[model samples]
Target: MGLSSRSAVAIHALTMLARWSDKSLTSAEIADSLASNPVLVRRILGSLRDADLVRSTEGRGGGWLLARAAREITLHDAYTAVEAGPVLSRHPHPPSDACEVGRNMQALLEAEFQDAERAMEERLSQTTIADLVQQVLTIERKIGRSAR
Candidate 1:
């Protein structure tokens, strides 16, 4: 029915990872930055790990790291890795068949939804975590905040 914040969080976490590629970061650390729960961050990280977008380690000085360069990962890639649901979904049951509008509404909406989704995917494909990181840092600098 609606979009989820998982994709946003994934992108944010990835941007941080990209910015600090020299060191690994624990779920708690990421959670702190996102103002979210460590468990939730861990869960999200698990999904990213499964998607091969991130790697994790345990024990002393262990944490998560990007599987590859930020430039190699796109917003669309992050969106898919989280298994976010479709941008649009139909009603559970068809509307009344007796109604002319109801009978063709789904078909009409489906086509439009597909086109919208394709357009969104195309735009996402053009952006990367590194790009987002750069934007964030630029804004921070403009606001007189250190980008660390």
Candidate 2:
């Protein structure tokens, strides 16, 4: 919705690993949960691996595992691990200096965009992968009760 789905994929992969922290998970398994393909999952996971958020093994029984505890990894950690560039976005080309509005817009937009991005980053830092796992289980419990 914001930019590329890299952050989302990375976060999803993280939570899945945390949920099954007792064992490692294959890219195929994580991809299945995402309704995505294994190659894309591996690509995003590779970013996480480079970021030191996850680790993997090779050969038989090889898979992915969290490098750190879920509680120790914030949404911001996952976000920055995979996604790059500014959050809000900027124009590809600079505005014209001759036009009054165009001349003023870029500077104003820059400040606004930076502020928005900082706010988003701060909010993301407040939550962790562990928090999401608990929330998912809590919601599932409630839904199960209602279905009875």
* Top candidate by lDDT: 2
Per-residue lDDT of candidate 1, residues 1-148 (tens digit): 5588898889888988898899999988899899999998988888999999999988999999999999999999998888666777767798988999999998998899889999999999999998998898899989999845
- Residue 135 alpha-carbon offset, candidate 1, angstroms: 0.7
lDDT of 2 by residue, 52-148 (tens): 9999998899999999999999999999998888877687798899999999999999999889999999999999999998887788798884211
The numbered model that scores best in TM-score is 1
- Where is model 2 more than 4 Å wrong at Cα? 145-148
Give all TM-scores, in the order shown: 0.95, 0.94
Q: What's model 2's lDDT at 113? A: 87
Clashing pairs in 1: none
The alpha-carbon lDDT assigned to residue 51 of candidate 2 equals: 92
Global fold similarity of model 1 (TM-score): 0.95
In candidate 1 the C-alpha lDDT for residue 6 amounts to 90
lDDT of 1 at 95: 90
